[model samples]
Target: MKSSKLSIKFRITFWYTLVFSLILALVFFYIYFLSKSYSVHDLQEELKDESADILENLYDKSSRNDILYNADWTKFYDDNVSISLYDKNSSFINGVLPEHFPDKVPFINNKVRQIKSDKNIWLVYDYCYEESPEDSIWVRSIASYGHWSRILYNMLWIFAVLFPITVFISAFVGYHILKKALQPIYTISDMAKEISFSVNLSKRIETSNTHDEFSYLADAFNSMIAKLEKSFEKEKQFTSDAAHELRTPISVIQSHCEYCLDELKLTDSVREEIEIIYKKTTYIGQLISQLLTISRTDKHSFKPQKEEVDLTLLIESVIEELQQKAAYKNISLLFEYIPQNESYIIQGDTMLLMRMIYNLIENAINYGINGGCVWINLIKNQENTDIIIKDNGIGIEKEHLDKIWNRFYRVDKSRSAGEGFGLGLSMVRFIVDIHGGSIAVKSKPGYGTTFTVSL
Candidate 1:
């Protein structure tokens, strides 16, 4: 029942008002009690002094019969003072005023008496003087109390009239100020909501005047978007390049098949044509397999069984496997292993690393001049391992050096006739990326190109 009746703001305000009102009521009650006690004390003291004067006057006259008992003595007393004078015999001289008074007047303790006729409640205390044994005085005064109901009646009006006005002004100003403070966040949220895969992510979040945490968040988000946009562009380029490369092999096979199907004679030239068709078909199949490997590598589907591999042993085996090919081209396959350590043990997938090395050497062999040098070096830095493949080949231009690692990007279109798919460096880059390594190339028009893989 309590939960259903109140809201959060109302409950908070209600509790606050309750606490405030309680404190205010307590303070007022304390003051009221204090003032009431002080008034009673003063009234009793005044009544005692008046009784002394009355007794002294009666003694000086030495006659009680001549004194008027009914004459008003109120002018001699304060407003709170009440007096009931008694003789030594305990008989009231004022003709038994207010019988509700205690029969035996209390000396120290106060007593309460309610008079129905006067509608008054008296706090009564008695005083006796030893010097005047003939007279005793009983003093009673009206005591006031704080009425909680009357106080609450006034407080209710104050709260009802003032609370809504105050809260309304506060919430009104708070809403506008909070909205302005969060304006940048709203703008960024709107922009992010509209962002799609097709959206140009070159746009960035707006920065505010303050250099605070929100600004830092905006900067970091922009950096993430930049990286995503670059990755998307790379993927699109890879798809286009793979399609073109696959089409070449498929078209060649189709053309040769069509030509052979139109032939009739079993001549030598016809046999040669048939052989060419077979070679094209075989090359097409090889291209298709290579294309699959590249696609799988790009998609991170080629999971390798990794082991600790000795770099020196791996390089030696690769050189041995490529020795005949190098010899056929008359290219010098120079191996430079300049490490004081016996073997460089690295954790990696051995087969993929071997394929990457082979591809790099094959690219050099295909492009390197006859009798030129292709240097393969393994160097170690402070915290990393480096593999440098430098070839004195038909070098790439400065403009093309940055793009050599992109798939199907060839420097010379005529030279594409060689069994190069232009995906070797791209595959090498992917392999390095998976290993948490980096690769770079440096080349000029006439000089040779150097590809450095740092792990």
Candidate 2:
């Protein structure tokens, strides 16, 4: 059987109750037995005093003819207390004797003892009276055991009634106390969760005025968050500054290469070298642009201008623009529109949305086989629109699939530098995120690759 799990509050309460119950049981037993011992001792002493008094009275009345024989013994006896007297000859004397009293009372030890007879228990005390040296009488006193038993029984009833009540009250009170003690922890956890998803890093967990462990924890968390916010801001500033500074140099290099190619007649080898330099400069400019875009997006500075966009026309336009590039590589580009409508409308930035589609289709063309086919399907549904771009080319490995969205992460590192700088997919992902859409890619090496955008 599986063991049931208990929460911290219940587990604490359980241990508390268990320990208290053990202590309570020990105290109850000690009190019961201690009280019984004292009661029995006091009863024995009282009996001894009564025996002495009876002996004194009998001694004073010894000279009378009928003092011992006719004296009223009923005055000294009740239902619970019994007294018996015996003469020196061991003959019966005038005194009260219980119905179940023993025939012979052992007086050699002169000690008190408890004796049971059928249903009744008795505390029997025996005493020897020396009335003159030669004549003596034995006295025995018996008290019922039911008095102390009743006292102990009532005590047990009290404990039986109070034990469960005490446990319940203890558990309830403990639960609330624990909840109050842990409330600050819950508050801190909630604040941390809010900070995780929110861009406002200035927010901190509230701390108490008292100096305690929880206050220390809150202070530590706030300090860590402050440090992280500072580090992130520095990184963003560096990216923005670096991209901006590189833009001018890249443009100067491209212009110099163009001037060299156009203004001077050069050999074929020299012209080829100039064209390569121009191509590299242009690639660097694009990389800088993508970096600036990503930095602006991180700083929440790139706000898309809202406008009605026809997604079908936008996609067709991108395909038309990239048709020559696809033709150069002999790749067939195909478009399949599920709705075939003239306009599939959405509210977004036309330029950014067009960039998003352009990146995906361009990636399909670049990565596909020379004569392979690339399929573009736009499916419209009741709730959303789906754009799928699929290519039968060199599909990505499984390990690199998740990392493709990261900036400057290339799946095939051995590819030529001119092929891709690894910024297109990153920009595509950024645009999808800004538009509150989702993009997913499924690829298997040597099979095919598929990109799905849901908006």
Who wins the lDDT comparison? Answer: 2
RMSD of each: 18.7, 5.9
Q: Give the Cα-based TM-score of candidate 1 against the true structure.
A: 0.44
Query: What would the per-residue lDDT of candidate 1 be over residues 1-455, giving only the tens digit for each residue?
Result: 45566544445555555666566667656766675567556545654565555555445544343332653656334444445555455566542244344355434424343322233344444444333655444333322212332454566677667656765665555556655766677777777765542255666788776778778778788888889878966875686577667777677776767666667556888777777877777666656656666655644235667899888888889989989988888999999987675567788999889978888887877787779889999998888889889988777767677787787777773235357767778788878877878888877655667888887
Q: How many clashing residue pairs are found in candidate 2?
A: 0
368-405 per-residue lDDT for model 2 (tens digits): 88898899998887877889999888888888888988
> Against the true structure, what is each candidate's TM-score?
0.44, 0.68
**What lDDT, from 0 to 1, does candidate 2 have?**
0.81
- What is the lDDT for 25 in model 1? 60
